[model samples]
Target chain A: MAYSEKVIDHYEHPRNVGALDKNDPGVGTGLVGAPACGDVMKLQIRVSPEGIIEDAKFKTFGCGSAIASSSLITEWVKGKSLDEAETIKNTQIAQHLALPPVKIHCSVLAEDAIKAAILDYRSKRSPAKAAE
Target chain B: MTTATATILKSLAEDRRNAPARPVYLDYQATTPLDPRVLNAMMPYFTEKFGNPHSRNHTHGWEAEQGVEQARQQIAELIGADEREIIFTSGATESNNLAVAGVARFYKDKKNHIITLVTEHKCVLDTCRHLEQEGFEVTYLPVEKNGLVDLDLLKRTITDKTVLVSIMGVNNEVGVIQPIKAIGEICRSRHVFFHTDCAQAAGKIPLDVEDMKIDLMSISGHKMYGPKGIGVLYVRRRPRVRLVALIHGGGQERGMRSGTLPAPLCVGLGEAAAICKREMATEAEQLTMLRDRFYASVTRRLPEVFLNGDEKQRIPGNLNISFAYVEGEGLMMGIKDLSVSSGSACTSASLEPSYVLRALGVGEDLAHTSLRIGFGRFTTEAEVDYAADRIVEAVQKLRDLSPLWEMAQEGVDIKSIKWAAH
Candidate 1:
């Protein structure tokens, strides 16, 4: 499948490619997808004291679409409030990348990573809320 | 021109200039470029000599018939079969269908069982599946890790009711050469018809039907540097192996395949077969050297690069490898300068890894990371070096971006952790 120019751009020069300190109270790491499924994306977000995402990083082992999706997500989630980051939909990512139907799952994985990271961050903030 | 149009045109020109050179072709198993010599021989037949080979009333017909017959002889000579035993088909897919389904249907009353290897091409496998719908029992035998059929297992699988055994000559995915001679011996001993799909084998390797006791064989033209849309099915005449006709029409190809043969394509296939027959040994040596050089260069620089098929028993030109911690499609994208096939599910419409690799017990993760690189007659030493360098570079780049690679570097076992399926 021919990748869109945007997908190629992200794949060639992925944004925010590294790991944050998952142990840090400010850092929330989301590891989504599966090795058996041929995609594993580790997306991390570090929140500031003001409850805004200060930094985002990702490492993805997948096809170009999957890598591009995660890279694009890192860029989209950084500098946004947790609520705003949570509102980022897979359709916007898929539309931005012009991902084919078969690759829409990559965008979904990216969306899942965002939600998981936010959930982890919220859970870390309130251990009792995480139990609920 | 308008300012916008002028700017667009200027950028278009720049884009054309900056466009990458044609990707170096390393996927010969998919199909090969037509040989120029074969094209030259086919030129006349396409123009002034365009005549139906079945048309016996005029000079045009006679000349076309002679060309077709000569092509038949050329193909027969390459595989050590009689010219009369050669029947022309559209391509290997059709030939395989005819060989597997045809034989099964012809002997349907006496035998209801057909045996074939799991690693056989989709054509053979799908044909077997279709036969199953027709009430024929097919035994899809699994191959060993080295991608070779167990002769004892094959022998035991054959029953009194089994009429045919279909196995591929060389696997298209991994290039593993099956033991056709041994399989043929068992089939002959047990009174069963043996057929092999030699699409990836015929020109690249030495095949003698009589010595191998092969009753039927399939060969594709494009796979052997010949023109597309032409292939051959070699049926044993001495043993009187008969197959029900798959295409029925104008009573052509001994009434087995009935269609007006394209004279040019037949000649091209013939010329290609003749060239392969003459240069098989020298070309094999050259390809073997190139393949080994490419393999060594990739392995020396990269760790955890596993060869997929049998090292020694594989064809001289193919090297199927899995680069651990790197996704196949991502690696292919990184090496845009090289053309190759990935065994990853992302490469196919169906999100399933290669059945051939899975049959060999290769893990889904490894199978998703596999690439099949093929060297052909036209491949060069420089191209091989360039390909190897690009592969190493791409694998390293992708691995750098891989979380799995990071985990592995930290000495973590990848299999121990539970992974989300999605």
Candidate 2:
């Protein structure tokens, strides 16, 4: 499986790799993909008061494609609002990374991480709405 | 820094980047580079001595037949069988198919049962599956956690309906050496035929057909530093083991396999077998030392590195290990200079981890994190050290990027967390 230049670049030098304070009110954490399934991606987003994603970080235990997917999503989400990030499709990521057919799941995981993080952030802001 | 020093460093970095050096090959179980001596011995047969072994009219045919016969003798000598018992096939897959399916179909009237290990090669398992489709009952015996078949279980599995027991001499994935002699004895006592796929063991380990009582054995040329596209199946002659021919036309190889034999590949396999017979002892010792050196270096420097198979009962050239919390494919990418095989699902089209590792009771996560490092006859001490260092470095790098590793270090039980399955 030959990785594209972008995937190789992100794998070799992953961007925004670290953990944010999961307990922080501003930080929304999305942990997706099962470890037993050979991938576990933890993508975190720190939302600003103005509703922008001020910072993003990710840590992934998976193949080069999964790590690259997470790394690329982190970079893409950092400057976007929650709504903008939620609109990011997995196909766009897959196309940009030139991932092969089997590796499209890595991009799907990245998209799921974004949605999960946004949901977690929205829930933290309005507990009543989340309970409903 | 001085401008001159910076210029030199930049050039050196570029030189390193542009260098087309081959990756240090550590996947010998997959295939081996053809030995120079074997190639030299095959060259004459390929060019001037080209003749169909089945053709008996001219000197050309006689010369090719002589080469094929010599190869048969050499291969037979390696496993303590007579030259007449050695039958040529396309490769190990064909040989395995011929041995398992041929024998079962030949004796299908009296016996409808076959026995084989769960950890046998895909070819063997698929052949058994095919036989099952044809109404033959196959008992897929499970192996112990150490990757060895339970001898007691084998004794109980044989019945009057059983015709053959096919087991592998050495595992392709984990490098576990099965007790062929014990299995053979059990089969013999039960009045059943025993077959073993010795592709991974032929040139690396000692095999005796007489002592082990192996009725049918498969050998691959490429796995033992010979050319590809040629293999041997040793059919015991004294007890008169019989099999229906898989291919029929020219009646070559005693009608077991019928095609014009490639004299070049035959000579290559012959020379390779002869070389292995002469040098197996010293070669195995050297490989063991190199393998151990690699294992020691990596394990000493890294934490949570687990060996995947029986440590002492495995082949000297194979080291299958799992770097905890590090995905195997990602680790392979990190160490691009080293060639290795991963048990991770990402390496294959399917999303399942290696069935061989799973059969050995390795956890799914560990199975996804395993790497099979094969050290061959040409591997050097320096190469081993370099590979070990690269592996240690890659594992550390991947571990740092792993959330599970971080959580484990913080005293959080990784299993306690509910992971969303994708």
Candidate 3:
């Protein structure tokens, strides 16, 4: 099957590749899944004290589906708040790429990574700040 | 080590030394080196035994005719087909075309839809596509990742308009075996003619024409230590199916394909089948063990390699694997000592990755990296092991230089990283 042009785009010159320091209060890293063909994604968002994502970086291990999903997730999570990123659905990624049924799991993985990264960033903050 | 094969390579080397300008013949799947014994059996016909059984006027044709009959019987016995059922053609492609086009054209008025799979040999796929262009509605069934057709899909796809279904017995690239018997039974019940391209499996596997309920099947001579340019199409006489002729003129092959038969090639084909009948069991067993050994060694030495197809349900002589980072041509260039193919022999020269692998949901990168290693009657255990080592080392060396491997090493989930399109 010819990869959808979007998949090809993400496969070459991937956006937001490399690591974010999870140790910094500004950095929240989300690690999810085993890297055994099931796409595993590590998304990190550097958040401001006011709760907006200031920066994002990600790494993905999987097929074109995995690559495209993670790539789409990184793009989606960049400027959103923690709650906003959590609201982003896997369906959106699938719909964007027109992912077939078999590769839908890839989008789901990316959505999960976005949530995990937001939660990672949220857990580092104070309860008062979270409630706010 | 088999003494027979150990000496063959040396003889090959001797020939290379003597004639440095000769073209190296590596296209084994297209045909094979005819055994000397088969050549001897056929030689008498060219000389004193020359005769046409059809010519009642003289002994020359009669003597030549006896060899043809004997060879026919041998071929029929080889596939466990009835003697009257085996019809000869120029090669497997012709046989395949006849089986498909013949049935579709015969039932042209009654049925318009034909079913075939995407992973079939080019001949079968092309014929189906050609039929489609001719206004026959064709449904190309998709194969699963392991290269086997989903039976439920087959059951669901057949309708009154469906006149036939053709699926290859053994995939030429991935080496996966389809469930032909189950499919044949399904088609038989549906009254749809079932055909299989058995070019790779005819001599390698146990094929009984009646047991599978196959309506038509294609076989090639060169695939099984036989001479090239001769093939067999097994047309079951039961219930009487009809296929239109692809070629016209002489009224040979029961008016299906009319051409002057290549006597020597046909005789060689029959002899090849006979030899396969006598030696298949032992040869298959040996090849399986060697293949297993090769896979184990290669996969162990190089971690994270992908073995394509249903590992358990493939031909005993075939091992196809996709090394993660190294491309096929680069690895092949590194391992120059051994000769093999990257995909189906017919399409290897094209820069495009095989259409068969693409149908299996394989991406372009991994698909191009695939290599098909086939062990024939003469491939010895030592060669398999040595080739395995060469492959493993080449993969390792290539991986060392790859950025993909570096990412995997750094615990960087490359799958999570969204890559941009090139």
Candidate 4:
């Protein structure tokens, strides 16, 4: 399948690829997908005191689409508030990357990673608010 | 290991700035480009001599008939068969169908059982499945871990009711060559007709109908650098192997496959067969060297990369490998400039892994990461070197991003960890 220029760009020069300290209270780490299923993405976001995402980093084991999806999301979620980041749906990621139907799961995983990372960060701040 | 591969390819890339933008074609198992000589032989038949081979009255018919008959002879010669035994068909899929279904249906009254390998092409497997619906029993025999069919198991599976034994000569995905000679001997002793799908085997390897004791064999034109839409089914004439015609009309191909034969395709196949016969020795040597060179270099630089099939019995042009901790599709993407196929079913319409590799007992993780890198007669050493470097580079890059690789490096048993469902 022909990857879109956006996917090619992200795959060739992926942004924010690294690991964050999972033990940090302000850091939320989302490890979603599986190696057996051919994709496993670790997306982490460090939230500031005011609820803004201070930084986002990701590492993914998957096809170009999966890596590109996670890489693209890391760029998208930074500086956004926790609530605003939660609004980042998979469709928007899919559209932004022009991912094909076969690679749509990559975008879904990216969206899930964002939410999961946000949840991890929120739980550290206020355990009662982590119910969602 | 991944870094080493990338380094090799990166250096090669520096020298290939002016190279063609298109990815190098390495998936020869899928199809091969037509040889220029074959094209030259076919050009006249396409324009000047476009007459139906079955037409009897006109000069146009005679010319077309000559082309078709000559092609039939050329194809027959490749497999050491008489010209009369060759039947033209649409392609290997149809040829396989005619052999599997046609043989079983024709002998259903006396024999209702058929035996085939698990690694046979989808067409052969699906055809046998269709026959099962018709009440004909089929034995899908398992292959050894090396991807070779068990001759003893095949012998034990044959019963008095067995009419046909269908096995592929060389696997398309792994390129392991089956023991056709031994299998043929067992089939012959048991009075069961032996049919081999030689689509991937035809011009790449030497095949003789008499020496192998094969009753029916399928040959695809396009796989051997011939034109598409043309194939040959070599039915044994000495023992008189008969199959119920799959396509019935106009009594063409001895009433086996009835259709107007394309003269150009016939001539192209003929020329291709002749060229293969003449160049098989040198081509095989060159391709084998190139294939091994690529394999040795990749494995030398890359750790945790495994070859999928038996190294010794495999086709010289095939080099299937699995890069641990990296998905095949992702690796393919990392090396977008190189054309290859992943064994992972995700690359296909289905989400399952390759059945062919699964038959060899390869783990699901390895299967998902496998790539089928095929070399051909036209492949150059430069291309092979470039491909090896690019693959290494991609595998390294993908591995760098893989969480599993990190765990493996840290001595963690990845299998023991429970993965999150989402």
| Candidate 1 TM-score over all chains jointly | 0.96
Question: Model 2, DockQ value?
Answer: 0.74
Model 3 chain B scores worst on lDDT over the 10 consecutive residues at B343-352
Give the DockQ (2 decimals) of all models: 0.68, 0.74, 0.03, 0.53
Which residues of candidate 4, in runs, are more than 4 Å off? A122-132, B1-20, B347-349
Candidate 2, CAPRI quality class derived from DockQ: medium
Summarize candidate 3's per-residue lDDT along B105-128 as a digit string, tens digits: 988999999899988888888888
In Å, residue B400's CA in model 2 sits off its true spot by: 0.7
How does chain B score by TM in each prediction?
A: 0.95, 0.95, 0.91, 0.94
Tens digits of per-residue lDDT, candidate 4, B1-422, equal 24444565577667678675778899999999988678777877867788888899999999999998999999989999999999999899999999999999888999999999999999999999999999999999998999998888888899999999999999999999999999999999999999999999999899999999999999999999999999999999899999999898888888898888888999999999999999998999999899889989999999999999888998898988989999988888888788899987664445678999989999877888999999997899999999999999988888888878877997988888788754
State the lDDT of candidate 2 residue by residue for B159-202, as single tens digits.
Answer: 99999999999999999999999999999998999999999999
Cα RMSD, model 4: 6.6
| Residue A29 Cα positional deviation in candidate 1, in Å, after optimal superposition | 0.8
Candidate 1 at B15: error in angstroms?
Answer: 19
Ten contiguous residues minimizing lDDT sum, candidate 2 chain B: B1-10
Q: What tens digits encode model 1's per-residue C-alpha lDDT throughout B1-422? A: 34444565578668968997779999999999987678777877877789888898999999999999999999999999999999999999999999999999999999999999899999999999999999999999999999999999999999999999999999999999999999999999999999999999999999999999999999999999999998999999998998899899988888899999989999999999999999999999999999989999999999999999888999998999999999998889999888999999785556688899999889999998999999999999999999999999989988989999999998999999888776
